[model samples]
Target chain A: MSDTFNFFEYYTHISQEDILLSYKGPLTDVLLSEFSRDIRAKLQEDRRTGKKVFAIFMEMAQNVLYYSKEINHFGNNDKVGTLVILNTETHYKIVTGNLVFKSSIPLLIEKCEIVNSLDRDALREYKRKLRSAPSEHESKGAGIGLVQAALTSDNPLEVKIKELQGDYAFFVLGVSVEK
Target chain B: MENLEIQGESGVYFIPTVKLRADTGVCEISGESYLEDTSEFYNAITNWLEQYIREIKKPLTFNFRLTYFNTSSSRSILDVLRVLKKFQEQGGKLTVNWYYPEDDESIAEEAEDYMKDTGLAINMFSFEPEE
Candidate 1:
């Protein structure tokens, strides 16, 4: 076949990966609620893993909704991002990607490193410290979403940063829970 | 002062049910909370607690029955716990109890972390997960 876009090829790739859900574009509250309902229903058979998967998904999705560099002005000015869920033999992986300011890469990397280095107790302690710290006006959230995600998944977070044109870069975060 | 009571809803966002009684000095926050305006919602509850502690000064029982709460809501919960800790420090009589699903250990662990963070004792109880 010629070097062209093939719909079946894309479909086959997705099927092979066992992608349960995938979404691109704006991340809004409405979308999150709907996705959460669907996920709860889809994973009803395994409530414990289902809860962990949902928790990690919410934390990561909210991270994108709040911090993505790209914003869609369709109505509520929601942030644009990508979210995908993959079911592997051993784990359920929730991955999210969004554009962020290039300057934030270092801090983001440090945060991820800190989260991945700690054990469960230590992660909880770290989350406590961050939560109790004096709140900055600009950042109302405790900035401990990643820490929470790590604790819930009981797996080290996987992070990848790609340099993009201008002042933005793509940030991808993956969290996995044992199935 | 008038009591504060907000009915929880699970529509676009999960709003935790809240009730702060002025007469009995019994306050409850139950249900799931994952709101976009997390801070705003918790701030009012925090303020109400402060007011109750200042004026009522009765023996207070704080009940937490949250099934799920996001990180932002966790921060707000800590804020509320801190207010209670302060009240206890000032010689105000108070008891804090937290309930979670028996299947979910994270919620119990979360309460433990809160206890460690605020230096306040929290009584943890686990119940059957709702059907």
Candidate 2:
């Protein structure tokens, strides 16, 4: 519940997976630039392999920028969150953690369930349907962004919710794009 | 009037390339778009498109070949599509073509979503990276 929890503690728990690059900072354009450079390098190493790693990375990074609750003075006015990328022997995993009010959990869970239940083709059709629907409450439930993330990812989307203090929850989403 | 073009850079946000031809009303928006100020970056394009619809009133052709764009940019893209929809309703001839990497199904889906959202007909094309 306390905002004083050391971020270093969280960093220590990252799995032993090979990290081509690790960045912890205010999510700003500057940080994104640096992060993109590192990711581009790693992606280039496998560029000839026909992997769409950068597109997946861009989605994860945007989620962190828009959903993270921890704010610093340096970054853009987007939301605050922590984002990490792990490169295993055969795939790349992108993890992002952000805070959302407890009230929104049900809606979030429903959206995820609906997205997960569909195959790639169905998901694409659903995404198109949502996109075409009139803007409800100013584009909050469009769900197009998350659907796009799922379609880009080869593995099923993984979502974990951890209860924080009174009305806040930390939501962690993991997506894997195969090489 | 004149074609609009913007270059891409690092750290400064993705500047989408815009090519609008007054003679033919053909506009193409390509490249990556993740701007620090989404409204500021896209305002001009939206306004230009609006003016073209009001003044030029020619058959409009739009081509989208963007590889990456953030959620905020997505909103602006919707705005562009909405304008085209309005123009079409007013008896303006409009055609939209969306190009995506063959492997990037997400982009293709995004284009489809826009078409569905606006009820506009769009031709979708897939391009594979050259070997």
TM-score of chain A of each: 0.92, 0.79
**Interface RMS for model 1:** 1.0
Cα displacement (Å) at residue B100, model 1: 1.4
True contacts kept of each: 0.89, 0.36
Query: Can you give the DockQ of every candidate in the order shown?
Result: 0.83, 0.34
- Collision count of model 2: 4
Model 2 chain A lDDT-worst window of ten: A47-56
Q: Would you list the clashing residue pairs of candidate 2?
A: A68-A80, A68-A81, A69-A80, A132-B117
| lDDT string, candidate 2, A56-77, tens digits | 6666677666556667655345
The clash count for each model shown is: 0, 4
Best by lDDT: 1
The Cα error of candidate 2 at residue B17, in Å, is 1.1
Give the docking tier of candidate 1: high
Distance from true location, Cα of B28 in model 2, Å: 1.7
Off by over 4 Å in 2: A1-17, A48-51, A73-80, A132-142, A165-167, B1-3, B127-131
- Tens digits of lDDT, candidate 1, A1-179: 67898999988887775787899999889999999988888888999999889888988898888889899988888899999999889989999999989998998899899899999888888888888887655554525889889999999989999998999999999998998
